[model samples]
Target: MSGDAAGGLESHDYDVVVIGAGGSGLRAAIAAHEAGARVAVVCKSLLGKAHTVMAEGGIAAAMGNRWKEDNWEVHFRDTMRGGKMLNHWRMAQLHAQEAPDRVLELETWGALFDRTEDGLISQRDFGGHKYARLAHVGDRTGLEMIRTLQQRTVALGIDVFMECTVTDLLKDTGAAEDRVAGAFAYWRESGRFVVFRAPSIVLATGGIGKSFKVTSNSWEYTGDGHALALRAGASLLNMEFVQFHPTGMVWPPSVKGLLVTESVRGDGGILKNADGKRFMFDYIPEFFKAETADSVEEADRWYDDKINNRRPPELLPRDEVARAINSEIKAGRGSPHGGIFLDIASRRSPEFIKRRLPSMYHQFKELADVDITAEPMEIGPTCHYVMGGVEVDPDTEQSGVTGLYAVGECSGGMHGSNRLGGNSLSDLLVFGRRAGEAAAAYAEGTARSRPTVAEADVAVAQERALAPFSGGEKASENPYTIQSELQQTMNDLVGIIRTAAELEESLVEIEAYQERARHLIVEGHRQYNPGWHLALDLANMLLVSECIAKAALARQESRGGHTRDDFPGPDPTWGAKNLVLSLDATGTGVNLKEQPLPVMPDELKEYFA
Candidate 1:
């Protein structure tokens, strides 16, 4: 298998292949290795440079270090409320219960989080939580977490294949069980094809935010994991719910879509309109009425005394805040840069600002040339995370396809309709470990002998991957043009606010892009060619875009990240179901199915009551 002369592909064998090197992938590889399975991690970029490094906010866990009253039950309740009760209860419960240990485990692996006065890990405030719960390190928590996990993986002697992109998941069709047989990938530097023959494949490739025009996500997130799962006969859940973070830098055109971490508002930043009014107070929804401050006095005072007073309206859940910001900008009350003003300069001391958000301070001072210590920063919504991906078993993290697993932002059901601010980090840790352990066990228990890879599948995969270089008549289509059009279409039509008409129009546009993607042209050879890479990425983006538009059109109600202007409220019937997307048996089209929500156990129901 090492020398496949027919396809000119190099082959390697491992018990488990983890197709990502971000937080989840590294953690999964480490766990699989510990479970006695030979493991390898394949990533498209250099280790430690995955998009996880861009995360600023801390991980959320009920460590009970900052607040004695905080516990997993409270965290679970907040998560459910944040997701508007659309979350898979078991996944949410597992995340909440296991997040603390995961955080502590990171610390043991040399992640130095900010320490409290009591010498414990420090916790900070964030939106959609009952108490201060984010374990941070000067707003660069992800960098520290990724570094620590990478170091741990190295120490555990796990194999890592950097700069590799997995194009397809190979499976055994002749066998009784259609389990994963291997994966086909190409080296980014050399453009040579390679295959990994493994009994289990774990897809930790992150979100699909790159499909939108204004996104905080990096280029690595092109729905690769989502598309791979779909084409591999797996289901995707809740694709309609895409989270738009409320605060992204709207000034300095070059950094227009860059993220402004929620830690700003968490640390007492206020949102104001051009009229100098705290506009968030007027935009508080009834859903948060019981917990939010209705007036400026209470809100300002609550910052000093969070125990007795309600939280500020500026600290509302991301979906609500993003919608309010969108409304403000549209109503001619926005800042000069077409966004709202976030003022932390007047709210906190300059020293505290620099200490707590060093990266944010540098980001503004260097990029926008505005000293955030003296002036407000203009910000708006940016596509940050997707609360949807491959559908999986809550406990095992295995998808519908046998021996295929997904974790991190690529897996669905943990965050439900909208993800909370700090939940993404913890979600990766808890579920990544779960996926690794489960995949290792499955591989060891079932894979008694080496699985066979079909030569026909390899031929088809190679043909599909190299079609862009064929220079056929249809190859005149430019990949960049189609990608840009698709981004703008998703951004405008299926963005923060949606209607049936716009979504239908988006579907039509997506179809056009899909057709263009088939004939995409790459001018240069494959070696380090970005055009060739994006040509491949466009297919995943278009497929995921179709799923989002179709699901958004079908769900005629507002819930969490998915807002329908035509149907302004959540429908009980829609709330009880999850929109599941899968590939049609023909493998040419997508099939949408509605799966009923799982019933919550009587014991867990008491928490909500």
Candidate 2:
């Protein structure tokens, strides 16, 4: 661990510091600690409250508890096909091969998954999988996963710094130049600065969904890790591809963007228009045509006998489903709330609906005053996940920057253009362990002594952190206003569908928000100040928003989550390339370059053939 003694700020040292404390962070911390390294987890909120808790669907793994035919090869094919063949071959392959072990590992750690009649862990059907592959605990799979991991971490005696937000990654300036030395952070409760000095830092900070107006993400999903990585000299890949989950609650002003889990569809719910027409059948894309049912009878029958019939069109990958929903609303067949109707009430029995989707039932009954077991849900597309983040090694999860590793939602390449439903939890477990093991190994192998902290760098960070209060009595710009405007801009222009003109316009609007963010003002003292925290988060959102817009503009062809109205279709040349984003030398402008996709190994190539 690097030693720090600058600016009189509070400091702690550790062999590894894992940021975000979500499923990935906790899992990574466990692996690192087990690998014989002292580890600490830093989080913006209390432990177990990270966005992973909101994940309702189960973890995807070819466990074969429900379907004996399922295996890693089938899982790999589903992943690559669902991603539109744009996923990093190695990451997808590794995720498929290792996911079953990770899920079984969780079971050993005390996760109480729902079981089949024979008493094996229950597996459920989700979009894009060829078999019933998701191991779940009712609809609260994430809750169970987090609870189990949290218990293991406590049992292992790993340290945790709760409600701490890391603002910057500090690097060694002298002989160990460009390598991460530590991180500068602040306590959310007391608003006092704290520095975590560590030899290795793993980012599991999640996505950038909050950058849009309607989203299924929480405030913490402001792209802090993505921005931090760029500032620390790491590149971001495929920034243009942002997933809009097809089933966000579209009614009730307060719950406009709350997620309606895809498990609703997986469990026999169907998408219908206001005229009572099943709409997904008419909207199947050419890519998914071979697997999706063309008729309503076949679609319904597949739920009971998946092997004898094609899968329902409603079970298409998220990108295609979201686009279908968008097109339905645009074609004047929308629900009362400008969305489509998701009818589980008409398809499944009330007892089965309540038993299978208890959370969805309660979430709707309590929040929206609608019982999902009896009524159809008003649903639409809402920004949910980013299929892009810090570009990292497929094997190690390490970024280009030395001593910096990323996993889970903050790291890219696992899901190429769009993620399949139920895949995220497995992703956290698989790559999170790899990141931890690799980071520990890197730290153990380094011979460099503790690096010194420059007083100037500390001073600059302190100054910037407190800048929101600098205007004092004459403070003008409201941080919330800028944040809201930025969200509106992204939602309006760079949303599920995009055009070259709107993307260009979005860049201009983002530039204006960036200017306002610079002058953001916050009232009151630092202690427990939400306004001040949002002010700091604004910087990250702007940087991430810029990357999204610029990358969207650069990629003209429509593919997956990034749809282009002007281009209209995926181009073969564009399909072979990835858009990589980084900070220029000045750190004021974004640099975007196209790179060719990695070739799949011959051993893995047989599965596709």
Candidate 3:
């Protein structure tokens, strides 16, 4: 809280400025530093608590020891199928191949994963994986991952700015092309602004989970990276594909939708109706016929992998499982509550269940007043992750904004419409490192491509800094209301199994909320106002939702996360297409374009089988 609260009138320069010090952020900083660049990792939260710490599922990779026949091809096929064939092939290919090495690298950097009999890292079964592909550190896999990267990064002595929010991207006004110079940010502690100008800026700010009332995300995930990139004029892809975790705590609506881990399912939890009937067998598709187990005996046998039995199909893609559960509830076969029951109690020994799923048990007992070991938890889909984000090249992870790069959930089109469960952790690790390496490579010979602190840029940053104070003392319409409304609209209208009418209605509703948000107010000083933080987040949610809804409206086919009722079948014409979005004056938003998919080489095409 030192002296100047004059907003962003003051300016600083660096070799690289990274927003969001999560797992991806830490990895990016390390890569940049190793590549000989002065680096800074800025964050809105205390070092280790970024949303990556909250991720409970394991990371996906083909360690291949458990199943010798396994390779990147099977992993790729599973990803495309899990995403309902909406996944980008090149990204999925790179993600699958690089994941094993990244996980091993983390182990070298001090991540202690659960071990097998031979003392190597162990793998486990998760939904949508053909083989046991996910390597984990108990249920707190993401936590172990972030902490490992954090410690390794500290050893390198990289610069870090905590509790600073990036308000705008500092674009190079010099006669340079589409490249960016760096960025400007708001320091929350002192309520001042700091301009960090660098040749490269990497955005790993997670997702817009904070915009929704019910989310698995924490307070720090405000979509800042997406908003900053959008305003800076980089096109986004697949905005319509927002994923809702199939299981979130239901009763005691006050606490809202906290996530129930997928690991519970991996540990033999059975999804049943109130009458004690298992319904997933009815939903298995013919496409998955070869691998999917049909009967309960066959399903159980899949666990042991008897000399000749088929694997369980109940572990089908997340989108498929979520839909199956939704159908159960709709057919009046649900529990006393609206959700289908997930019972791990009867399937496995109580001791094994407790040891493997300690956090799930603890989280439910502490937060929801229920023990999963004894009772089946109530759950329904809530907006969880977005598959689409700032469009970036496969190798570089750089968006159209030359100096700006994206990684993690903020950058989209990676998962297409539906992401497989463990791939997200791997996506962060693999692509995050690539982005860092590429950005650092670009930053090596590049000097300050723009003015360090030109007068005009400082003026705009200063105005941004004083925005909360500028509104009259009694600013109305709480920002949280806008946030809640956003979640409600998206959940009710744009959720799983949507319609043209619903999408159009949601678009109009989002617009109305956007107008209402204009009249929204921020109270008190900006020092630590959660309210002001929420207000800024509302703008991002509004704009991002508009693109999602518009893309949903335009796509006319049911594929991946974007399901339209009028068009119930997947249209072949739309199979290889992508929807691109950006912000401009008219509010009509950016138009759709048919971006080409990577031609799968003959060698790679064999993986599709």
Candidate 4:
């Protein structure tokens, strides 16, 4: 890999540099600045609109004020169970324990969560959660969280590099070329290039949501962090289990994969058949049958819990719920559009619905021309969070590569297979801070490391940016067309479920995409060239998808977020193998290896169990 940053129209340096100013990135920058490092937050969008703003549910944490039964141990167990036991025990433990402190810290920094009458932060029930432990604002919880972090970071005087995209990592070396020096990025507004020379770098660059055709992810969620890390020579773990959310609005092609917030369901909404009957009862898994309420009578009883009964059945885990909806539609009991109906009208009064779910009402009426309060909303699974990422020590958030760090959705082993609804927000706070602290500490004494950018690396990045404009490769297909084709292939094949036959085909298709990318053409100059940026992103997403599909094929036994019909049960022998994959300096190909699991101590075991 070339170590130099290309298109160096402008150049700068810093003590620490952070890519992507989303929730985790903002928080990391704050911590690094606090640690006395000169920090800069380079982002793709305007400060507030990074993917974090679209997070609709609440932040998961165990404050333990309302429910005495609630604590980090219970939260950890629920996370492991929700992830189907594939989550790293240590990561889950630390995240659960530290989440409450982080949420309270947000409050101290001016986040205003909804409050109970007694005035503690309010919590809500969400899929895969064992308690009403998600601390939230009305529905725009992620927006509130990121806004608060953005404010705090700005107040700290950390440098903000808005509308800039990092194209490569610049490594400095003392003949050996093994350590980090800084990075290269380009300005989006003026078409100017900049090289940020720093001993420390933090990547919190969100997900590969755009990799799927129909997704809740914005254009910014192109797995930038995932791609950046791979190029810098770090191994990504468990890329197989990408989470497909159960309730993306399925009508109006423009909004096809946009998310329908879970808050609707949390506020007494129900999933129904075309005949309007609730169907979750028939689909509860064995592990959760004890906590699941089976009948309408039990469901009605839980509304007040006056004559006391189990919690409602409507709150089942997301995977089981999505599968149930899929079955209902397959049995010809679906709405006209082939999706189950999500209705809140029957359960709550119009006044209650209007007040509690204003955003849902607004979004459906504005975007879909359907008033959610009066009409049944059309819903189906769509691509959402990625479960696999660069493997790190669950607590430290450090990658295998020296001086490299990952946080938020980009780091692996946190959610295991499927992440619970509210857990992501809390996990971001927990690990983002950990990664920032660790990176800052590493940068303190080791500021000038061995690896610095070599001229060859700069040329690789410059040519990489110029490839589409060169217009010499696949002249027949447009870059956007290839991108759309790639997303469809992944969605149809490596989506919610998987098989070895389909995975092998996906591999072939991905290879073809790599070849086609070489010939992609662009119509405009470097200034705001969406096509060029996408062509660049395709390389990353394709690599990420390869890791996911290949690893899915390797793990013959089903566990957590991975469900293979051919290999339907978790094999004890495969107990704790972490599949780690990385690319060489040339980005020619990849090598995957297995690393042993960190042993769980008694303290971790008690909490993990």
Stretches of model 1 off by over 4 angstroms after superposition? 1-7, 307-309
- The TM-score measured for candidate 1 stands at 0.98
Per-residue lDDT over 457-498 for candidate 4, one digit per residue giving the tens place of the 0 to 100 score: 766766676666766544555778888988998887777778
Task: Estimate every model's Cα lDDT from 0 to 1.
Answer: 0.91, 0.90, 0.79, 0.80
Worst 10 residues of 4 by lDDT: 1-10
Residue-level lDDT of model 2, residues 387-440, one tens digit each, is: 999999999999999899999999998899989998999999999999999988
Of the pair 2 and 4, which is ahead by lDDT? 2
Better by lDDT, candidate 3 or 1: 1
Alpha-carbon deviation at 440 in model 2, angstroms: 1.0
Q: How many clashing residue pairs are found in candidate 3? A: 2
> TM-score of each candidate?
0.98, 0.97, 0.95, 0.95
lDDT of 1: 0.91
* Clash count of each predicted structure: 0, 0, 2, 17
Q: Which residue pairs collide in model 2, if any?
A: none
Off by over 4 Å in 3: 1-10, 306-309, 448-453, 471-475, 585-590
Q: What number of backbone clashes does candidate 1 have, counting pairs of residues 3 or more apart or in separate chains?
A: 0
Q: Is candidate 1 or candidate 4 better by TM-score?
A: 1
lDDT of 3 by residue, 292-333 (tens): 788888887766653343655557777777778878888898
In the predicted model 1, the residue pairs found to clash are none
